[model samples]
Target: MKNVVITGTSRGIGLELVKLFAEEDFNILALSRNAEPVSSIELDNVSAFSFDLGTEVDLKKASDFVENEWNGKVDILIHNAGAFLNKPFQETALEEFRRIYEVNVFGLIGLTQQLMPFMDSSSHIVSISSMGGVQGSMKFAGLSAYSSSKAAIITLTELLAEEYKESGPVFNVLALGAVQTEMLAEAFPGLEAPLSAAEMASYIKNFSLTGSKFYNGKLLQVSNSTP
Candidate 1:
């Protein structure tokens, strides 16, 4: 009977999460820039919605629809749609940085704020971050745009957890090391191997429902192999 609303459901972790959770009978509200199959004979519990999070107009519409459709109660809100611009700090353009933050930070905050009223005592807010967000990693070059934004997101989640404590919702971040998704291919193309998206999605599912009891507010890290 959990009501779940997930943004950025077109591809990568977001898409995998949508399909995986819908199969489990959670009432799903899926929003993405790309079209998702709606009214499926197979997935009767899914209501697929599409909108670009980088723009304000699209986000307003998405918020209105989701708020009305979900009817002022969301047990879980997963902010999984984000982007990475893999240019060195020197080469990264201001516009590219803006685009990265547009999706990673601004859009995410916008959607969360719009849905905040619906978050009740038991609501859970989960954001996907990265190990890059962790303190000064192994000196990887040309990831300034991504790492910085993710680091900020991690802090944002923590602060949000404190800010909304009265509502009893748990806002947290997951600094997953690396997973096989389109984002990975784009961020670091030609990698020999990476963790499968479905496998990671499964871990997220299990963790959210159970491990969360012991793991709230901690930057839970999960991978095929630990870094």
Candidate 2:
């Protein structure tokens, strides 16, 4: 069976990804801050791990779980954990900016590094980015930290792809448009998103499993341009 590790599986796109992949019979290592949502599902192929991206202890525990249980061989790794800070540049405090980076950037790198031993040449690493970070898009006022962090994800993915070009695992990032999720709701109140979390999850599933066969280090943007 193919082994898949996904972060931020408590809800939103992460939750949906777990459900979708479960249907395809993949062994799922679901990581979330709260394990209740995933544990309630009660699937034999799915295991829930409670963790916080900003917590070093939690990250170490998660890596330990993967190393021991998964035999250090993962087929796919999805980085979906993120923090949002919707404050104007001047209003955004240094601590808040650091918090965002801790989860979106540092923690992501730390976790990925820990899990590298469990990945083979056929493994794929996918990070969910945002359109806010993509160039040529109109910048919003209150997303300085969040957008910049996502932009960092894109660059990081590209660099990893280059560094691992002759190696085995593939790296890619999806610069998603507004998806109707709690994160989007919190970031942009009352604005309806053109895409749903389930929809995005489906796209991510297909891409994670097959897109690597054709593309690597590509920042594929998905949006309806309704904003």
Candidate 3:
């Protein structure tokens, strides 16, 4: 079986991803603040680590611990821990931008950097992005903060994918369309996602485990009904 690591496993897509992967019998190193309550992760195949991604210290420590914690094995790494804030470009606070990018950008990079020491050849790193990253849809009005942050994620993923091309591991960003999750409702209240979180998780596990053939480092949209 494969060993996987996922961030933001407390709820939403992260939680769903953990659930699906666990059901598939993959050993998971799940990270989040409140993961103890998750029954799915209580099994022998799953282990939870509680830590806030905003701090660089936590990233370093968690990565080190997970390396030893998982017996130095990880086949897939998923950077799914993220936050969302919707507001006009003007009203968006610089601190808000910092906070959003802290978890979405710097923090994710920090954690990945530390985790790489443990990952062997032929592993995959999947960063969960958004459709907002690719297009300036009508959704761009109040999503300046959220969209811009995800855009940064895509750019980062691309840059890292290139750096890790010949060596290191496979790095790809999944520009997932709106899925039933708290982050979506925060951006657009009362709007339902075309896909459920479980469906999204199913697709992610399948796509992430594909052959190491290097696809162009770009954002990918996840469609559950068909992938």
Q: Please name the candidate that would achieve the greatest TM-score relative to the true structure.
A: 2
lDDT of 2: 0.90
Cα error, residue 109 of model 1, in Å, equals 0.6
- Candidates in order, TM-scores: namely 0.90, 0.97, 0.91
In candidate 2, stretches whose alpha carbon ends up further than 4 angstroms from where it belongs are none
Sort the candidates on lDDT, descending order.
2, 3, 1
Candidate 1 lDDT, 1-227, residue by residue in tens: 88887877777777778788888899888887775444343577887756777777876776676567767688888888888777779988888988988888888898888777777767788888888777655435787887788888888987887776766678778888778777777776876335788877777766666644564566765544323
Selected candidate, larger TM-score, 2 vs 3 = 2
Residue-by-residue lDDT tens digits, candidate 3, 175-221:
87778888877877887778888888878778778834556365787
Misplaced by over 4 Å in model 3 are: 39-41, 135-138, 214-216, 223-227
Local accuracy by lDDT, each model: 0.76, 0.90, 0.79
Q: Which candidate is the best by lDDT?
A: 2
User: What's the residue-level lDDT of 67 in candidate 2?
Assistant: 76
- Taking all chains together, the TM-score of candidate 2 against the true structure is 0.97
On TM-score, who's better, 1 or 3?
Answer: 3
- Per-residue lDDT, model 2, residue 108, is 90
